[model samples]
Target: MVTKLPLAVLLSASMLLSGCTVVDLDENGQPILPKDPAAKASFSSQTPQQIAQENWDSRVLKGAQDRALTWNDMKNKSTALKAETSSSVFVKATGTVTAVSDDAERERLLTVTINGESVPVAIGPVIRSNAIRDAAGFKFEEFTNQVQFARLTKALNQQNVQQLPKIDGSWVGKPVQLTLAVTLQPQRIEDAVAVVIKQEQP
Candidate 1:
């Protein structure tokens, strides 16, 4: 008769014999997977759900602030390119609200004139882009799998829209200051998602 060990026992023994460490400790407790040294650390331990549980309050805000540039500087192509990571960047701009999209639209946006350029800030019931996620400095390469990364990006976008206070006609014609996270494919400024909007200080 042949004897068989439980699946769990076999797996544990395999890991022990392989001498594989689950995480490298310096990383914030995410499990090691799909090791790629050419880029930043990648992990497999944490699921999109686990990371998304905290919502927009996670490190995204600080990351955006720390890596942002003034609107004037970012408007220059070379400067913006240098600031980009994974083809996105964070920009801090002070602008006058030039126009606000109709509330009836499912995808609403606030058009702000930053240095005389009309830039659309999506204050959304529906946000359709990955600008916020890309601008926060996270690259797609850092994720172990595409499905999880896509799910995480979707969760991040939802959290982003949810984090905003209500937008209304009252906000039009107001001067606002914001650190905007944008993608850099043609106009997006960042890949790591971070956005902070505040009334401009006089």
Candidate 2:
């Protein structure tokens, strides 16, 4: 049925559509602004892409800080090998390395310190994150805080950028699963493995 619309409704819709039109300073009057100059200044900002990039970088840095781990945290927790042998032998290192030859490798070198009498040795393929948990219902992500990362940075020589392996997002809180690809001497590997097993026991 034909009906007459109220003049007020029609005028309001027209005003809204007109407001969206691009106003040219050369043609239209100086850009209409709020009573306060500061409020108006903030409106003329960067494009959407620039804003998104800024937000992404901020989140990435925060995530890196959140997931960062310390040397001791990585040592006591992520080491595949750790044991209180006859001698208090402890090997804690964090970094990435590339094999040079059958018997040689280049270590970017961050930090390494041992308390007991032992040869200073290092191996790579080391990637760690405090984002795991254990069967005992222990959460490891708690160890990835800033305090831990600072300690790790002080103790181990790590690369400028440490890349962690992709873990199933679902398994984060279920069990502690850390993957370390170390190229240790056979004997050292055996020792480290023994230590790690002992530590994990119970």
RMSD of each: 10.4, 19.6
Instruction: In model 1, state the lDDT of residue 22.
Output: 55
Lowest-lDDT window of 10 residues in candidate 1? 185-194
Candidate 1 all-Cα RMSD? 10.4
Worst 10 residues of 2 by lDDT: 193-202
What local lDDT score does residue 56 receive in model 2, on the 0 to 100 scale?
30
Clashes of 1: 20
Query: Candidate 1 residues 61-160, lDDT tens each?
Result: 7767677877666656434354334355677878888887888997788888788877888777777777766666566676777887777777777777
Count the clashes in each prediction: 20, 11
What C-alpha lDDT does candidate 2 achieve relative to the native structure? 0.30
lDDT of 1 at 87: 54
- TM-scores of the candidates in the order shown: 0.67, 0.18
